[model samples]
Target: MKKTILITGAGTGIGKDAAFALALRGHRVLATTQTEAQSDVLRIEATNRNVVLEIFKLDITLEADREAIAAYPIDVLLNNAGMGESGSLAEVDMQRVRQIFEVNLFATLALTQVALRGMIAREKGTVLFVSSIAGRVPMPFLMPYSMSKFALSAAGAGLRAEMDQLKKNIQIALIEPGAIHTGFNQAMTNSKYQWMNASSYFAHQAEAMKKKERATFKFLEARSTQGIVNQIVKAAEASRPKLRYVSPWIQGFGIRLARIFGV
Candidate 1:
C-alpha cells in the first residue's frame, strides 16, 4: 500500500531523513525545500538511491509556495518545515517573535488548511505534524520556538476533534521528538541571537545559552533517528493512529510527566 507523500523542509534534519526513508519504503515522495540548493541535493540523493522522489521549492511562508503544493495530489502531508528563535522572553525582539510565528505557526497552519480541504474531499488522507517536545514542556530561553509548537499542538488537537465531529476518515498525527540526531540543535544555535551577544546585560546569559546548546547537541547526536522515523512511518500507515505520537522513550516519558506535573 504505497502512498503519495509530500514533506516540507525536506532538505535537512528529520525532514530529509523521513523523506528518504519513506521514499525507500516505496512511497511516491515529493520532498520540498526552501532553496534550490536543497532541492538539488535531495533530487540527486533520491536519484542515486533509485527512490521515487520529486523535489519542490517551497519556503512554506509564501502564498505562492502553498498554491504550488495544492497542485499535487498528495495522500499524506508532512508539515516539517519550521524555524527556531532563542532569547529571554522579555529580551526577545518583537519583530523576531512575529517572524517565528509567521513561519512556524502561520505558514504551517495555512498549508494545513490548504491540505485539509483536499483531504476532506478525498475523505482518506493523513497529515503528520512535526512538532517538538518544547510544545509539551516549557524549556528555558526558547520561548519563541516553544510558543509556536504550543500553537501547533493546539491546532492539531482541534483539527483532530473536528475530524471526529465530521466523521471523516482523515487522520492527524503529531511527531513530537525530543532531541534526535538532527542538525536541529545546531540550527537553533546558529539562528538569530546576536541581540543577546550584543547586550551587556545579557552577555552572561548568552554564554549560558551556548553551554546548554553544546550539551543538547552532544545528547542528540547520541540518539538514533530510526526510532522517530519508525514512529512517523507507522503513524502514516496505521489504521488507527493515536492523536499525538511522541518519539523516543525518554521524550515520551517526559511529556507524560509534563502532563502529570501540569506543565
Candidate 2:
C-alpha cells in the first residue's frame, strides 16, 4: 500500500537515502531537514533523481516546526534527526549532554506525541526511531549520544506495548544501525577532540585515542548504508513491524554476544 511517510533529518546519510528509496518505491515521502538550505538541496536532489518528494524545513527541536507535523496525515513517522557528542561524562559539559537529550530524546518525543494524537484518532500508524547499536552497549567517550539513544530505544519499546494494550493498531519500532560509513560515525568519534585540551583528563592519551577510533571505524564501519536502509524499508512497509530492526547483522550479533558475556 502507498503510505505517506514523514522523515526527519532527510538532508543526508541514512535518512536521505531512506527518503529517496521510499519515494522511489511509490510512497509519498515528506523529507524534512533541519535547515532551509538542506531542504532546498534535498528538493534539487529529488528532482535530479526524478523521484517526487515533499521537501521542507523542520528542525525537530523547534516547537513551530514540530507543530507542522499535525498538518499532514502521515502514515509513518521516522524520527531520524539526532545529534552526537563525545566526551567523558565526568568532565563533559552538562549543557552539551542536555542538548543531546533535547534533540535525540525530548524533541523526538515531542514530535512523536504530535503525530500520535492524529494516529490514535485515525486508529492506525507506525513510528520508527533511529537508535544505535551503541545504545545496546556502553561506549566510552560516546556516552552522551549513546545515552540518548538508550533512552529512545527504551521509549520505543514501551510505546509499542502501550499501543498494543490500547488496541489502536499503532506500530512502534527501533532501527539500530551499526557503524555505517555515513560520515556520521567519523564525526561522532572525532567530536570529543573538539573540547579536549592539554589540561583535560584524557589529554595524555588523546593521540592514542584518535588512532584507536580511526582504526576501529576503518575495521567496523560498513562502506555503505544499504544494509541499514534495507532494514528501514522493511520496518516501514511491514504490517506488523518487529520491536527492533538492526543492520549489518554481524555487528548486531557481536553486540548481542558481548552483552550476553558481560563484555
Candidate 3:
C-alpha cells in the first residue's frame, strides 16, 4: 500500500538516503531539509537519481517550518532530524545540552503531537523517531546527544503504550541506529576540541578521549547507510510496527550482550 511519508532532515545523511529509497518503493515522500540550499541540493539529487521527491526547507526548531507539515495528508511522520552535542558531563556547557534538548526532544515532541492530531482524527498512522544506539549505552563525551536520545527512546515506548491503550491503529517506532559513516559522528567528536583548552578541568584527558572517540567510530561505524534506511522503510510499512529498530545488527547485538553482561 502506497503512503505519503513526511521526513525531516532529509537533506543528507541517513534521512537523505531513506527518502530516495522510500520514494523508489513508490511512496510519496516529502523530504524536508534544514535550509533552502539543502533543499535545492536535494531537488537536484532527486532529479539525478530519477526519483520523485517533494523537497522543501524545514528547520525543526522554527514554528513556521513545523507548521508547514499541516499541509500534507501524511500517513507516516519520520522524525529523522536531530543534532549532536559532545562534551564531558562535568565540564560541558549546560547551554549546549539545553540546545540539544530543544531540537532532539522538545521540538520533536511538538511536531509529533501535531502529526498525532491528524492521525488520531483518522485513527491510523505511523511515527518513527530516529534515535541512536548511544541512547542505550553510555558513550564517553557524547552525553548531551545521548541524553536527548534516551529521552526519545522513553518517549517512543511511552507513546506506543498510550496508543495501544486507546485502541488506535497508530504506531510509533524508535530507530536506534549504531554508528554510521554519515560525517555526523566525526563532526560531533571533533566539535569538543574546537572549544576545549587548558582552562578546562578535563584538559588532561581530553586529547586521549578524542583519540579514542575517533578510533571507536573508525572501527564501529558502518560504512553504509542502507542498514538504517531499511529499518526506516520496514517501520513505515509494518502492519504492527515493533517498538524498536536497532540497526547494523552486530552493533545492536553487541549492545544487547553488554546489557545482559551488565556492562
- The most accurate candidate by TM-score is 2
lDDT of 1: 0.83
Residues 118-145, candidate 3, lDDT per residue (tens digit)? 8888888999999988888777788999
Q: What is the TM-score of each candidate against the true structure?
A: 0.93, 0.99, 0.97
Question: What are the lDDT figures for the candidates, one per model?
Answer: 0.83, 0.94, 0.91
Ranking, TM-score, top scorer first: 2, 3, 1
List candidate 1 segments past 4 Å from native.
190-192, 198-200, 220-222
Task: Locate the minimum summed-lDDT window of 10 residues in model 2.
Answer: 185-194
Tens digits of per-residue lDDT, candidate 1, 20-124, equal 899888889899999988899888887887777889899898898897877777788999998888777876788998998999889998998888788888888
The digit string of per-residue lDDT tens for model 2 on 1-263 reads 99999999999999999999999899999999999999998888888989999999999999999998899999999999988899899899999899999999999999999999999999999999999998999899999998999999999999999999999989999999999988887898788888899989999999998999999999999999999999999999999999999999999999999999996
For this target, which candidate reaches the highest lDDT against the unseen true structure?
2
**RMSD values, in order shown:** 1.7, 0.7, 1.0
How accurate locally is residue 190 in candidate 3, as Cα lDDT from 0 to 100? Answer: 80
Judging by TM-score, tell me the better candidate of 2 and 3.
2
> What is the model-wide C-alpha lDDT for candidate 3?
0.91
Which residue pairs in candidate 2 collide? none
